[model samples]
Structures are given as structure tokens and as C-alpha cells.
Target: MSIMDASGLPATTPDSNQYSAIPTTPSFPPPSRRVSYVASPSLTSLASQLPSNLGRSRQVHDLVRALGLLQDEEQEGQGGRDGDEGRASSPPRATILPPLKVGRKEIGRFHDLDYVDALLSPKTVVSPTNSPTSSPSSSSQSSSDDEEESDSSSSPKRKRFKPDPTPTSNLSRKLLSLQKFGLLDDSPPFPSLAPYVLALAGAALRAAQSVKDGTSDVALCWDGGRHHGRREAASGFCYINDAVLVILSLLQQRISIPNPPLSDPQEEDDRPEKTRKPRILYLDFDVHHGDGVANAFLSPLSLPHPTSSTTTSTSSKPLPGTPQVVTLSIHHHAVGFFPSSSLSSLTAIDTPHPHTLSLPLQVGASASSLKRVWEDCVEKVRESWKPDWVVVCCGVDGMAGDGKGVWNLGASEEEGELGWCVRKVVDWKGGIRGKVLLGGGGYNHPNAARAFANFTSIALGRPPLDPRTPIPEEGIADEDWESFAPSFDLEVPVGNMRDLNSSDYLDDVCQTFAVLAERIRTI
Candidate 1:
């Protein structure tokens, strides 16, 4: 069977080795404000800032740099003081970040104060000062607070709160803090990883703010889709649920002040009052379910009303945060999948909630099956909620040969899906136009990079790369790029995993979506 592009046209594979370098692309072009790339300077600067000594992936870093996605200093240059001519000439090496208050506010919107504080309070042992002398000089700091990681048994006991055994209580603060920030081997808190998570989240929030403010129409968070995290606990290597925060931040359209009893309390100052929440359609194309984001907006804390079969009377008042963002997840589903219970339950129901739509394709789902799912989902949402903003968790694990995925969608199909989704959002009839694309679980690092790069091409309205075109293994990066030279070659064939889904199963899915569509119209 011939592979189809997002536009329903035949996609011809190009020479694999030829990298399409956009020579005319400005360092940071003004027209590209249509799509913003949300990357934190800390991605490189804080490579060694992990308490466990674990850092950002060197492969992702090399691929990104090789693709010329890095923003130049001139684009982020700082203004000098009144009469300092010398300072004006000396450009700062750091990328100016959005305010900490803003990020805290956004995180607080989706997560409880206690959980947010738990993440923020942990201190990483590694700092820029402690960075190896041979490492490049960077502006990334270890932690905002100077409090170093310490053991109370050996060091002076810090001020302690009166005991309250509940996890939310102030008493649990110290223990939770220790669990998260302490040694990595113990309890798997991996508190040291919190900074990187926050950095990705903060960058996304900034991008969302910029979009809301009309500064940009599209935002790309290449490293910020840890979809499996829950409000209370981290799972699947995700500590803080950045995707949830991004949605909440965009919906609220303002930063909320963080006021917590679990840690050093901050004075509450409401600068940006909550605006009318936008109708959001969040699409998760990852192989695994985006349980964190799906549960966040669909839960009673956000959406109290369930999807109704009949329309509500006009006189009834809507619930707080009512008509919550509609989340659609299309992923491989089976009894053995990770975090299987809740997600699998969605498929069991004849009619699931409109807010939490799940298309759990059977294992070994093919490109054609995915396309059908996408078409049905897009049609249902368009006829029902008609979202004002689109957020996509663009994970490529479904690609053949993924470490964690079993489906067989290749680069062409993946790119096609993203391209189609973005184009639809951009062409929505209403004035509403915004999209935030996030990277999720793609374990095959090189393929992940290639997929992301191809998506970037689509986002920029550039021609799609020929799938056959080989990526030159040499001249990409130094030693790190060379190590993966074999994976970089264009000759690797993508296996076609045939669709194992039966016609009866597909009919049931269609019926479920139809029921969901009718249910959402009631809201």
C-alpha cells in the first residue's frame, strides 16, 4: 500500500542523505512569529544540574543544534543602562526567562499548592558554580534558593512544622521534600529533575502567554510532554506534568500568585485576573495515553458535569470551569499497556464523557487505522465543541522500532497527522487561531529527532523532506553525533505493522464517538 501525506496526496520519498538547509532562513525571522519555539536556555546550561548527576539527553541537544533551531544572542540581546555604552556593546550570554511568579501561578492553576511546593522546594546539589571546569560556561543556576541538599541527621535540623500526617499537610512537607530531593535510588523521587521539568513548563507557559497576547500563533515545546504524570504523583519518568500546566496556563490567560502553607509562603498578588477560558481541543497522538492532561480538565475539580445524553435547560447555571477543554487521545491500547485501568475503561463504556475522548486502538495499529481515527475525531470535535485553541502531544513512539511502542506509523504518516491537525486549527472559521505542539514519548532518539524536524518543516510551511533522503551522519555534531551514526543513515527501512483491528471494533469506536459528539452538544 502506498503511504499518504496529511493532504491525502502521495508522498514521494526524497534522497535520505541530503539535509534541506534553509539558507535564507533568518537567525530569527519576524514572520515566523506565527510559530514560536519554546526552548529554555537551561536545556544546555543546566545539563549537569541534576542532583543524581543525570542531565538532558546529549543526542537531542546535538540534533537540535544541527537543525539550526537554536536562537542567536542577537535575537535575545539585552538593552544597556542609561549611559553605559560598553554594556550596550557587550551582549548577555543568558536567555531572559519569563518571570518566576508567572510560572508558579500557572503550575498552581492545575496542581495543588502542596504538590507544587513539594516540587519547588527540592534543591539540586549541582549548580553552575559546581559544574565541571571543562564544561562550557553557562548562565544556568542550580536552584533559585541557596539551600543545599543536606541530611538532617548530620546537619542542623531545619525549622519543622507541627505534625499533620496527611500528604497535603505542612508536616508531610519535610518528608516529601526529602523524598523528592534526596538520593535518586531512594523512593525514585528524582527531585533533581524538577528544575528541567519546570524550565520546559515555564517556557511553554511563556509561549502560551505570547500566543494569547497575539505575539505568536504557534508554540513548539520540543521537550515538554511528560503525559503520564498525575496531579499527586509522577510516573513514566515525569515528575511535574508540564502539559497540564501549559493547558491551564493558556486557559486562564494569566499567571496566578503562589500562596502555600507547605513552604516559604509568598505574598499573593493577582496581576492578571482570570480571563474567559478558551475552548481547547487537546490532541494526544502519543502511543501511550495522556492520562494526566485527560484527568486534569475532565475531573470534578475542573468539570463537575458529566456528558449528558440530553441538552441542559437554558435556565441551569454552568459549573465552575464548565465546558472544560475537550481532550482526545489516540494511542495503542491493550490489557498490558502502562497505566491501563482508567484508559481501558473508556473503551469499555458504550458512551464515554465528551470531555475525555479516548481512541484506544488495538496493538499493531497501522497508518491507515490512525488516519481513520484522526478523521473521525476531528469531525466530531468540529461538529461539537469547535475548540478555540489546539494543543497536540506529538509523540512518535507509534513509529516502527520504537523501544516502547508497538504500532507501525512511519515518519510520513506522523508528519501528515500533525500537518493536517495544524492546518485545520489555523483554518478554523472563527477568529480563534492558536496551537501549541509538544514532544512526548519517542524512545528511538534519532527517529524522534527526524520526526520533530519534519514537523517543524510543516509548521514553517516548507516542503516536506523526502523520506528516502538520508541524514548525513557526519558534520552533525562531534563525538556524540558519531556514536549514533548508524541510526542516522537514511537506508533503514520502516516496518509496516498491519492494522489488527476488526471492522466490528471500528464500528463500535465510531458509535462511541457519535455518542460523545451528541453528549458534548448538551454542554
Candidate 2:
């Protein structure tokens, strides 16, 4: 039943073409490479999710191999080949983090605090001027664009005496404590938030390293559902908000690798200013209000940025030419409609000055709500916060009928471009400029395959022009994607998709029919 659009392909039709224009406030890296975070178990499920962890790590490794992210250690050892594949003798390892068991339910953790802050407060805008009049200053900078790559051909074998320097020493231990011990949120005397701060900072450093070299242009990662989590405790599924960690990491890394002022002051004035934290347009379109992400920023910064520290000013104080790093999550209006508590309650900290609302829908929350939310958040924030890079927490549960909060009191078959819509906006934007990385999120096991496929589509566009399947050449005019009446669901329950000779309807939208030479060249 899928129909092609003016672009000659399946199009995700939203309620309206409201926020389709390119966002000026938000921006991500130039269509850098699209990296997929895949693991054996594609989706982020399982109590321990151990086996899946290894698979996810493999996804990272595979991309690295394909894009050559890491140095080739054995090019010389095994002839002068590229050593891109089939060079490893041992099996890959799983990143199975010990299942976070709280009572009977398996939970998730948030290793980074900044990510937590950003989620909770998406609209804390910052101007992109270097060494601005107001803000926190830092030191001990790491090499931002300075890195040396080992030659693939005769990379020397060194002793195992090398130590992997962690930005924060206690990070891994605390990650263990934060994950396994579970006492992290409460200000336990000795334990440090430093670990998570550094873990995320290290991640940012690594990403920066990746960018400095020609290794990676775009990166996608799904992490830390921390809305329910608090400064002192794990709420919902999050243990240590990793998003905050990344943000904080970038901040710390920026400090460590000090931003030496441009030699030319006029040059700095003349050119587009770079952000301390990659001006990231962190967009989350899941049905749930990316509450965790929104909360992080909204929550008063532990050590407030200068902007956070200053007296709140008028929105019209002449916006900055460039944007500093920021997070913006538009959600279904929750003021009086739902959550009972006023939206202000969630905005206890520094919620975006004027939070956007997706509002409860009339026809019981059709797919349009999803598209609206995406468009609105991007558009509203466009003038204020265009990111240098974008990170999308791809949560598929909101496709149609969702359980964990979409503001829809009831459920409905969210047909048409359900997940397709989310994929389209990000993918299309990526096609033009900036990169969009897919990070798995909030899903149950049975639905994992579809989620993985969606991510696959995002990474590799439109299913790679299926060679086996031919496009309809007859050019029927005007039927949209859902027009074919893809009658059957993924669970069509046995029998063939359609009886070609019987003149019966084709129940299965994705059905693969077998035909002889007669069906072919019939055009």
C-alpha cells in the first residue's frame, strides 16, 4: 500500500507542512558521516542487556572499520592490505552492562549529569561569542584538532605498558558504583560525579578527536533516560544520565583544550563563531517529552554557566549571531491537560523561557502529533539555537498507539508515516547538510526488528535502491504512500500475500510475490 510522493518515494505525511523549513537556530555538523549504534540485540531492551551490549559495540567497531575510525594495528603484519575486515582472530566482545536491578524491575542509569541538566532545560540559550563577557572560564585543555595517526603499513607493536588515560580517574569505578552500587544520586561522601563528567567529556574528546582527524563526521548515540532520575537518586530507568556526561564532557574538554583566541580579532568577528559545546541541536521526538533531556538544562547548572548565573533578561536583547551548545525538546502541552501538575512544576529549574507545546490531539493522537512535535521544536529554536551537530534519540514507541505518555488519553492505529516521519526529517536534513546519528531508545523486545530497520534506513538511505525489487514504471498518478492500502500488518498470519490471478486485494504491504517471465516485462 505504500505510495511514492513528488520525490518519487514513500513520503511521511505530517498533519501539516508547518516546520519543514531549515532551522536557523539549530544546526549540527555538516552531513558528517552517519554512524549507527547497533548491537547484537538491536534495540535497547533486556534487564541486563548484556548480549546486546557486545552487539552494540560491534556496531561501533564495524563503523570504525568501514570508516576507519581507529588505527589499523596490523597492516604490516598481514601484508600491506587495508586490513579493513576479516583481520581479527578473536571474537568481538559484548558491552553487556550488568542489568540494573532495582527490586524486581531492570533499570537504566545516567552516567553524565550535564545530559540530565540539558534534558530538563532545553531553552537555556547561549551566544556563540568566544570568551564572552559572562561565563565560566577553564584550563588544562586537551588537543582539539591536534592528533597523530599511526601508519597502517608498519604500525609498530608496542608493549602493553600503555595506559588508557581517563579524563577522570574515578569515572569507570563510579560508573560501576553508579550502575551497580546504585547509591550515586545521593551525595555519598567519597564518590565523585567527576567520573561521569569525564566519561562524557572523554566521549566528547574522542568525538572531537574523530572530527579532528578525517575519521568521523557524524555520530549517533542513545543514552540515559533520566527524567525520572534526580541529582541524588535514580528515577524511572536512569541510573547516571549519560547525556549530561557528554555535555559536561564537552565543556570540560573545551576548558582542557583552551580555545586560543583567533589571532585576528576581526577574523573572529568576520567568521561564524564555533560553540564551546558543539552547537548541537539535540532533538528527541519520542511521544514522551524528552523530559530527561529537557530537565538537565532546565535544572540550574550545578556550577551555573555565566548566562545561567546572570539575572534573566528580555528575550529581545538582540540574539547572538551564533549559538552556543543547547538542547530544545517541544512536548504535548502538559500545563492543565495532563500530568495534573502545572508545566511549571516540571520547569522548577530553568526550563526553556517559553516551552513549546505539541498539545493533545483531537482525533485521538494521529501520526501528525509526532511530526508536529518534530517540526515545532526545530522551528521555534531555529533562530535561537541552530546546532553544529544533532543527536536524535530515536524512540519508535510513539509511532501510533503508545503507552508511556503521548498526551493521548486513548490509542489509535498510528498508520501512514509513523516512524517514517521521524526518519524522514532527520534523514532529509542529513542529505542536505549536517549529520544525524541514530541512537536506540525506549522499546520492548518484540518490536526490536522494526526499530533496527528504521535505524538502518536512517544510516543507509531508503533501503539502498533494492536491486531485486523493481520500481513501478507505469507511473500511476497521485496515490500517496498509504494509498496502496497495505492491508496486512507485520503479523499477516500465514497464507500468500496476494492471489495474483484471483483479483483479490494484496493484504500485505511488504509482501514479496513470486512470478514467472510473464509477470516480468509485462510493461
Candidate 3:
């Protein structure tokens, strides 16, 4: 929980900014183009880094291919039309930024150098006891020899423990990093995970940078939303918190940054539209609390006070010109969840915090409860925050029937929830502006693909589909993709989940909101 400098550089040196700032601007496609994304032929090379049978790597590969193919089709169709015709036929989406490969410096912005090295260069050391070359002591051997003759007739031979061939490179031992954090029990099939992690981070940075420069109002990085990463440790299947890095990238564009190579004033002058630091509102809709992101924004004793000092301190301390980043997570708060130890627990609600709100729901939470939380708590915070930029962690695990989730939000209702949340945040930022969409924890891969596709369309400002309209032919061209593409029309009905919002739970939610609102007001 160290405080990252506004520029996202290490805060150790007194004047590190002089040596670290780089005036790197993202290259984005034309705004009129259909959704700009971040996949490349290099994706195959990156996927090759891991074993073919690895589940997480396979998921990443599938998503990249699916999105790339979808974008190509959309662009081909849009290319045939011009100006008004094209505008009328196609949906509105932000320009796609060119694919970027983040180097060590970029990774260092949000992570420690030692941690980054650990992730990229892990080595397994074997002790003498575990090594095969070391033999038993002479005294033990002598003692055993006397008894060996009597026992030899009845005793069985034991097999020697042979160590597996050691991997000489970092790519082969990448899973060891996860094991180090206690998130994994053993090494996974995939060892070359660094490329995918870097790719996700690059995609998110591309989106945020594009938004900052005004070429693209929103950027979608469907692969990046690992919000459980800590500065030194990993948790909740997250190694690097790409969402935090994205915010830092966006903030760098607006903050009074130093050491711009002493020659890139033209880049600075080009962005006259930005007079002040942009306000950011981060929303996480995953079934787990965005504890890593919340940790980044925490300040000591910034929580609410029992006495009237809360109001007095607010009036006494001068508010900064730029608002602190505001984060709100709407997720399951059930006991003994996968991330039960983190702030995802219900007990987190009682603690005072600043610039963040965790709205955790009980098990079997229905669409109605979710709607109420969004309207009463999420909306209020958004209104007060009045963000100039918004980053959303859209995790589809909250949908009904997800194996890893307990929420009962049915298919249609879950889709509705995502659409509603996106529309609200987009409208808050003004249509087609200042939104960065990221993917997070969605274990149900098929349903996740379906949900993201629907949400992608929503980001493009498209209207809701009619129940009578047939499903797109491309949507179900192959059996492999059928899970991603529903057979029925987009309007297929799904009943509300079983309601678990008892009166007491509802009261707790209301009280939590009241306390949160008071705390935010002070900020």
C-alpha cells in the first residue's frame, strides 16, 4: 500500500521525474472507423509462449481471435458506405489504438522493479536433501548393512525421488510467481505468461491515452482488468493490476508532468483542450471486490469521524484542484467466497474509507437488489464525483448460472445490468467520451463472450435489439462459437433471480450508503 506518485513513477528519488518522463503518444485510427482494438499477428507468437492445453492462455487466444475477426467484418461492411450512410448503418465506437508492447519502464510505473523481475525471471533452487547427487551418511549405511541381511528377504525396494528437468529460462517458470503468492498450489501448464500480461496492460494504456488526446472518446481493452494485484503480491488470479496502471497513464496526460525531453512542447501545446487534471470515476462490476484498486486510492485516517470534526476538517483543509480518483465496486459480499479474506467481505462496509465505496451484496442477490444499489449508491457517487474520465471493470461472473458465482441475476437481467451501467457512465461523461472498458473475472467463458459482445455494442451507442429480429448469421457460423453467440434473438427472456434481499440486509445497504455518502462529501 505505497502511494504511487501522480506520474506513476517510483517515489524513491527526489527528482526521478527528470530522468523518467517519456512523451509517448498513442497512435489511434480514425474516429469514423468501427471499433479500434489491440490484437495483432504477434498474438499467435504470444499464445505460443504457453502450452496449448493451458486454460487461461487458451481463453486469451480465443478472445483475441474472436474480437479481431468481428472488427474486420464490421470494418469491411463500413468501408462500402460513406459519411451519412455509414453513420446511419454502423454503430458508434471509439477509434482503435495501434497495438503496443510495454517495455520494462512502462511496467515499472505501477510495480516494483524487483517484483517485475521476479515475474519475468523466476528460478527454482533445490537443496542438498532434495538433490539426487547427495548420499546417506556412512554411519547410517553401516548400521543398515547389519540389519539388511535379515530384512532383505521380506523388505521391498523403494524408488528414488527424481527431480523433474529444471527449466533454465523465466518463461518456463512463470507460474512459480503465482505459487509464491499462494494463489496457486502448483505450477500450471502455462509458463510463458509474461507476454499476455504485458499485452493486456498495453491495450488498457492505449485506450486511456487515446481518450486523453481526444481522438477516441472511449477505448475497450477486453483483456485487461486484473484488479487484485498488489505492489508486491498477487491474489484472486491477478498478477498485475492493469486497471491501476491505466488510471495512472490517464492521469499522466493531465498532470503537470516534468522532463518532457525538453523538446516535446508541441505535444503539450496540441492538447490545449485540457486545462486541468481530468476527474476519474472507476467502477468494478465483478463478483469480487476491487481491493487492489481500492488500496491504491487509500489515505491514512481519511475515513469518517464520530464527532463533527468530519465537517470541520473538510472545511479547514483546502481541497486540491484535481479530484482524487473515485472507485466503486458492486459485487457479492457472501461469506467464504474465493476472495473472502479481502475487502469483499461484509465487514468491509463498517470501516471508514475515502475516495472509494464497496457495495457488497448477499448471496442470491437478484436484479432488483443490484438495480437499487446502482441507483441509490452508485449513481449518487457518480453525480458527486462528476468524472471527466471513467474506467469500468466489467466482469460477467455476476451473471446467473456462473459456476464461480452465487448471484442469481438471470441472463437477460445480467445483460441489462451491464448495458445500464455502461450507458449511465458514458452519458455521465457526455456521449462517446472519456470511457475505458476493461474485462475482469468471468469464469464462465461462453457467457462472458456473449456478455462482452453485447456490451461492446452498447459502447458504440447502438439501440436495443428487437425480440423479433433474427440472430446475426455471423454470430453462429460455427459450432465452436455457438456459446458466444446465442441461437435465439437478443431479446430472449430470462426471469429475475431468486430474491435474497431480506429487510435487514436492505437496511444494512442503506446504512452503508449513508456512511459512504458522508465520507465522500468530506472529500
Q: Which structure is stronger by TM-score: 2 or 3?
A: 3
TM for every model, in the order presented, reads 0.68, 0.42, 0.70
Q: Model 2 over residues 1-523: C-alpha lDDT tens digits?
A: 2233453332334211111111112222222233322221112221122222222322222222222222232322321112234433311211111111121011113333443343223122112221111122322222232234455689643211111244343333333333333332322212223223223223333432332332333333433323333454444444444454444433332312245688877663444444443445555544445555555555233322223556333353323322234454433444543223233222222223322212222223434443443343344344344444555555444432233434221111122233454444445442222443333333432222233333443443332212122212222123311221233112111112221211121211102111111111110
Better by TM-score, candidate 3 or 1: 3
Question: Per-residue lDDT for 255-374 in model 1, tens only?
Answer: 333443444357565444443446787888888888878877675532213433343435433445465588888887777787574754444333335577788888777756766766
lDDT of each: 0.56, 0.32, 0.56
lDDT (10s digit) by residue, model 3, range 41-128: 3432343242211233233334333332233433433421133543453334333344466866787788877766665552422233
Where is model 1 more than 4 Å wrong at Cα? 1-33, 45-58, 68-106, 122-191, 254-276, 301-311, 314-321, 347-352, 413-430, 472-475, 487-493
